[model samples]
Target: MAGETRIWTPIDYEADGKQSDCLRLPHSTDLSAYGWVPIPLVCIKNGTGPTALLIAGNHGDEYEGQIALSNLARETRHHKVSGRLVILPALNFPAVAAGRRVSPLDEGNLNRSFPGDAAGSPTQMIAHYVCAVLIPMADIVVDLHSGGRSLDYVASALVRPGRTAEEHEKLLRLMRLFGAPISFISDGTGGGGLTTLAAAAQEQGALALTTELGGGATLSKAGLALAEAGLKRLLKDQEILRDVAVEPASPTRFMTVRGHSAFVYAPSRGIFEPAADIGAEVLGGQIAGRIHFPDLPTREPETLFFETSGLVACRRAPSLTERGDCLFKVMADIDVGPDQVSHA
Candidate 1:
């Protein structure tokens, strides 16, 4: 009880049928001392079966997941489901409403705030609720994401390597089912590590998957389409949506993010000129981009190079950047052995 979340929901998760409500996160502000922030929730249940938790908008700036999940919440009906479907279109409501990557209320990044404290900020509270309540009730969890405001990414699905080989294989199968053009494996060192929603779900014995659809704070048509189609396919594969027809997933190129070398960061504040686009193959020491010092016209532009060889999975969207800002992230191909070819 000491570390339990303070948030309360009006809808009963155990009850059958379709229900739409909000998780009331207590916020004692100056306008209304007892007011609560409403985080939208949708639940569709039919009979006994596995439970799937679909989430998006972990970062407010990411639009693909939010749009896809919202459409899903509206279109999916209770009768169509054999098990339970839990949809959270905007998990971090404050950030989503503010159109920010982190919550405006507490400036917290939900994706980096998993296994949160009960008495933490609003974003942390939401994270805590999901980890303490929702994840335990789920058999599978999907957290949709994109590059957000700063970066643009090749539409991709990702999974953290599971604790056991069997678990890792299952995660890979689910990732392939999502059907994104690119499937990458995270070693949990790229960022967030165990603090991410995927890690939390995995720790709770649930298979978790995440995606990077598009970015620059704009809607990506390809990303949205991928998100929509993939969700349907995943639901069908899980036997949750009995009435929907889903096509078999296409082949996905497998990749992996090696340590810090996979990232290319700006060395100084300046305008960046990209040397490679997303999905471009480059070798280590190749010019990634040039940072121009517009203020000092005479100064030679500093050139940045890739530290690792791979495909450019994501790149900064904004031309102007600060020192240490990630300019590009390269993901190398996964060397699948003979035994793992069947999954690919």
Candidate 2:
């Protein structure tokens, strides 16, 4: 009881049919001393089998995952499911409601708050409930994501390499089955790596998968279609969905994000003029883009170059830039082999 989460849900996770409810996270504010934030939750159970925990809205501005999970929650019924399906379409309800990447309540990034505290902020409480409660009940976990307002991604599915070779293989198989255009084998060492939901799930022995569908704080038609189709295929293949007719997975290119060289950052605050588009293949030392000072039109624009040769997997969406802002992220093809399955 020392580390128990304060959030409580009325939905019975073991029930035979579908149940929808809200996870009540306490928010003691001036307006209402007894107020609670309602985080939407849907659980579908049919007998006993493996459980799949699907989540989205870790970053609120990411639209693809939010829409996909919302559709799944609305469309799916208990009769169609062979096992259990737990859907958390908007995990960070505060951020999702504000349409922001971080929660306005405490400016907390849900993705960076795993293994969270029971006595922490609202975001941490939600994260604690997820890792301590939901993840343990899952055989597999799928977290959908996108670039949000700052960047645009070339639709890709990512998996964190497991601790053992056998576990790694299982994760790889699931990534391929999702059938995104690109399969990324991530070492999970950047941007709050170990604190991510994927990492928490992996540490708990649950096969975890994440995706980057699209970005720019808007819905992408292509990204939405891929999310819908891939989710159905994954569920059916895992035998969680019984009667769904899912199409065979298409070919996915294997890739990985190497070292710091894979990223391009803005050197100073200026307007960014990109030289390469998202998904463009670039060589090392290639001119990535230029930073222009609008105030000093007479001065020359400072050009930036790529440090690694690879495909541009993500690019900054906004033209206005700031110092140290990530302008580009490049990904290289992974040489699939027995020994090269996991990156160090």
Candidate 3:
């Protein structure tokens, strides 16, 4: 460790580190209206192991995942890592400030605009920075996420396809290192968005995994704890840290959703009453929820049901409902087979 240079990217932040006051890296530019956001690309420069990136807050509303990655950056400052660790805890600052799903001005979901252009919109510029700057430099990328808005996500991982079976297995090992309770595998390329930055890392042949830690808007202690444990596991798995323990689960149960899936929505506007819970299995034509028409005869409540069979991955919020509103999403199981399909 004598020859190693532990470089911390200095930025214009508050004394308590709550606010971003200035750019840490001297070479900073205002890409858009978001002001001088710091691109904290620090490195140990030992030149001995793999370089890994941990990113979060692609969607501003997912606070738990953002907090987990932020805490990791703060706690591991003095740790002797085997390789480089780049942490971008909050990528969408404006949106995070508003506690909204997408940027308020452009009304763009940063996750959807991937490999963004420099001269495009503000979100595009950020996307462009991510793709052009941090991504290419990473050897392994872990994009952290949580349910944005009014939803909660069970812990899961989404991996890209096209890796060799051996490489796929290796990717799974790294995903497990995060130690999420449930590990879901889908092709990373399927979703065309800025959030698919993990897939971009995979495209570069860097072992990548995108994880969902908890729900949206708020932080859960259990979710944060799981992510903290998982990150340490990942650090040990990548040889960036020592004395870490791996939570062993032989034959890890991973659910796969391949190809196009049906998203069930409420056909008629009414108060929504859901019958099934998240992670529930359903048969085709299963009655999922009811849209009770307010101030009606109440004899014919509009029934919402699944068209195909799978799991209830996501559901709409609350008693409020509108015509053509999404009630729940059903992902029909497909064969991933030898070919890997890109999933979001």
Candidate 4:
């Protein structure tokens, strides 16, 4: 952990102290120089054991996760932590303000640009900074997220596959601490990459998990409360905080996806009418939605059916469909090893 002590740029480590200002990344430009900007990172570091980093705002449209993280920072500012707590309330500052998924400058999705490049696109630089600086310093990491922009998702903890029974149990315990109703283990649903910071942390052998709230291009008090309470539970479970009373997790059924499930799409251009809701279980050959032609009012619309059985984890909001556009994604139930899958 000697080399791991320093993350990203140059910032001296101060145990359990507040810094009134954020440290600015060198050569970071404002909107005047480039079409985008990087704001100084406002970090609150506390405690002195293994570090745990809490991050949010990777996708601008997922506002609830960011807000939840921000709210936790405010409530726990004076918290006496046992381990180092690094809070990056908002990583994609510009995107959060604009309410979009990708960086507005190059329209790049920041989550996909891991271990970023200084001379690359704006999003790339952000990935580089987070991967190089913040991630290396932590023993465990919890990334906050939700469906971006036009998608709606059920709240769940997406964990990697192929863990020993102990690892799996530990992860489940963490999920219960997250206080979410569902926990979907990511059995290679998201491919390995340099784009996502979560992947970067996992690659370093950290106990990493991504907590997704229920929101897309919107925010809600319920979602925010879940996020805050989940973090508190995690911190307490990690032994970083001493006085939190965490509820024992109820018996949970962990489902694994058999393979890359399909996101049902529009067969033709027209308005889409979905018949199912998020988190609803569907069967193979089930009619989930229909595609209607705007001009051909007299002609009957085409109904779309599911090819496999699983949960409807994501669905388009407008119920309006476009040709070849995905309207729903089915997460089929299957068994997979925790180490066998990695969502980089």
Candidate 5:
């Protein structure tokens, strides 16, 4: 597998106007002798302006972003665009087709495979192309995401800390404009650059933002609507699509992930019974949940408590969970003005 060498693509970014094409990734299988995996992409260009990379489906089980981006690609007109817009609704086609979070070909989570190997598995190749070809061509990137099968979350936008004063401001500004009800500033300690696409985008010096709209292994109508509305507003905010009407930006609550304390993980394999609800505020040391051992009826269920006092931003969806699984995570409110953000 070539590392940083050039890779072939079926879509032309500079072709001009509106066009839909697939990124042909070479793959050989038992069913087809010289078959190639097709990644759907759409590019719309009107005149000279910045390029925006709009993407979804990094995790195949997340459907809100994929549906919204697909509808956007199909409905957007080139004449309405002042800059370039490239849409990739499904980056990991194999995973999406299989309804799994990671690609079955190599068990690769595309979100965690950034700066990947060129001649690696199908998932890694896609990640490598994104790092090599896509990021360099983008001025801004908006990656839509949500909690996958094992979890559910309140709608929110996420940004990593450690950016320059100017870059940080721009990042939060766009995230506020996203209007997802909650604006989250990541601790940067949980997931590093190579582990998440959001960090990868920031490493490339492009303004980046991601979201957690909804989850539970099912799509939410409200979440889908929110994604579509935010996608259009973000493009208009960037002036990529001129004359597009934007929805009024509602105020978003600011929150910070306070390292490991912000999350509560399952201690032993059991059925989870949550005490606090999503979006609800709670105090530290409060009972977050209890794990019941179904097999051992005589055993007392283990109780889990909150590590920090904050809002319930996310929770485990499936009742039956194993050891090492995350049970719930909290985010504390803070202050964020137009020019700056600080913890309250």
Candidate 6:
């Protein structure tokens, strides 16, 4: 039963054609002696070339990637593709179906489950297959994400640091090719390996590009277009797709999250009123917003200020705030090349 412990897809992996099927994960319950969880996936393959693994819906609330990916899965034909394209539009199927960040079945956060256990929970099994099986078959991987219901972000491409210098250069190239307005270099510093699908992919020698399109538990039109266009561009750039007119890569602003100072957190629990909008340039000591105490109508809202000056890359969407909640995350510009502007 060792082989039964791993996920099994219903399509022939080496077949040269397009197939859409569910990855079956064995599950047993009182209702059925043997059951299976169906995870949606699609594989498009032609002749020999680089394989690209495109994924989305790591968090169920983020919709841009799923929308764009579903569209691609339905419309993309094997005739135009040169290599394999394995796409999982909703990686965390249960979470996406529930429209929540974590899986309702096992309460699992998929992004945090890397190098997972085969005999683990539902979400962990999915992660285990992705880490140990699917990724090894790819030359590149792209995981699309957003701020979900909690935050909003400037449409950006993010790749964590720690890859070899050569791998880092490849990631940067892929990020630029995706053509998002801003490209972020995350060291994966404070995430504590929780936000780690891309990092895991990177470690497997796959040039991974992750995106934070737009969020609020709804899809963004512009963000979806960007995602669709970017995926096409990536396939073309990798020479995996033919007869595709690749769009020009937009000039990207290179930036990085320096450290803790790049974030501004709520001082006390209250309703937040933002002073600076997303994408706004702010000063080091600028007023970012205030947290209002609604219970005490007579009391003043505690004003919060930006600790570091830079472009407002991300901000909490919900007005309701709690102490230690991150109100904003700033990204400082870095020198990527001579042609790029000083982001700081």
Clash totals, every prediction? 0, 0, 11, 22, 1, 1
Candidate 5, run of 10 with poorest lDDT: 335-344
Highest-scoring model, lDDT: 2
Question: Model 5, 1-344: lDDT tens per residue?
Answer: 24763347656788778988888888889998788888888989887899999888899999999999999898889998988999999988888888888998889999888777788878888988988888888988888888889889899888876467777788778887888899888735665444677777888998888889899989988889889888788888889876878788778888886678788999999999999988999999999999999899999999999989999988999999999998888888766533333221
Hey, what RMSD does candidate 1 come out at? Answer: 2.7
Top model by TM-score, which number?
A: 2
lDDT of 3 by residue, 254-276 (tens): 55654444566677768889887
lDDT of 2: 0.90
Taking all chains together, the TM-score of candidate 2 against the true structure is 0.97
TM-score of each: 0.96, 0.97, 0.80, 0.85, 0.94, 0.93
Off by over 4 Å in 6: 1-5, 29-33, 192-195, 337-344
The reply for model 4, stretches above 4 Å from the true place, is 1-11, 23-31, 34-40, 162-169, 187-194, 334-344
To one decimal, what is the Cα RMSD in angstroms of model 5 from the true structure? 2.5
Task: After the best TM-score superposition of candidate 5, give how far the Cα of residue 332 lies from its true spot, in angstroms.
Answer: 1.1
lDDT of 1: 0.89
Instruction: Rank all candidate structures by their lDDT, best first, as comma-separated numbers.
Output: 2, 1, 6, 5, 4, 3
> RMSD in angstroms, all models?
2.7, 1.6, 6.5, 3.8, 2.5, 3.0
| Model 5, global lDDT | 0.84
- Alpha-carbon local distance difference test for all models: 0.89, 0.90, 0.64, 0.67, 0.84, 0.85
What digit string (tens of lDDT, one per residue) describes model 4 on residues 121-237? 666667766676677788778888887767777776777642477776666567656767666676343343434676677777677778667765677666677777777777877
TM-score of 3: 0.80
Whichever of 1 and 2 has more lDDT, that candidate is 2
lDDT by residue for model 1 over 1-344, one digit each (tens)? 13978999988888899999989999888998999999999999988999999999899999999999999999888988998999999999898999999999999999889888789888888999999899999999999999999999999998877777788888888988999999987756657877899988998899999999999999999999999999998889899986797777889998887778889989999999999999999999899989999999999999889998989999999999999999998988875422331111
By TM-score, the better pick of 4 and 6 is: 6
Off by over 4 Å in 3: 1-47, 188-195, 245-251, 258-262, 295-299, 331-337, 340-344
Q: Over the stretch 257-322, how does candidate 2's per-residue lDDT look in tens digits?
A: 887878999999999999999999999999999999999999899999999999999999999999
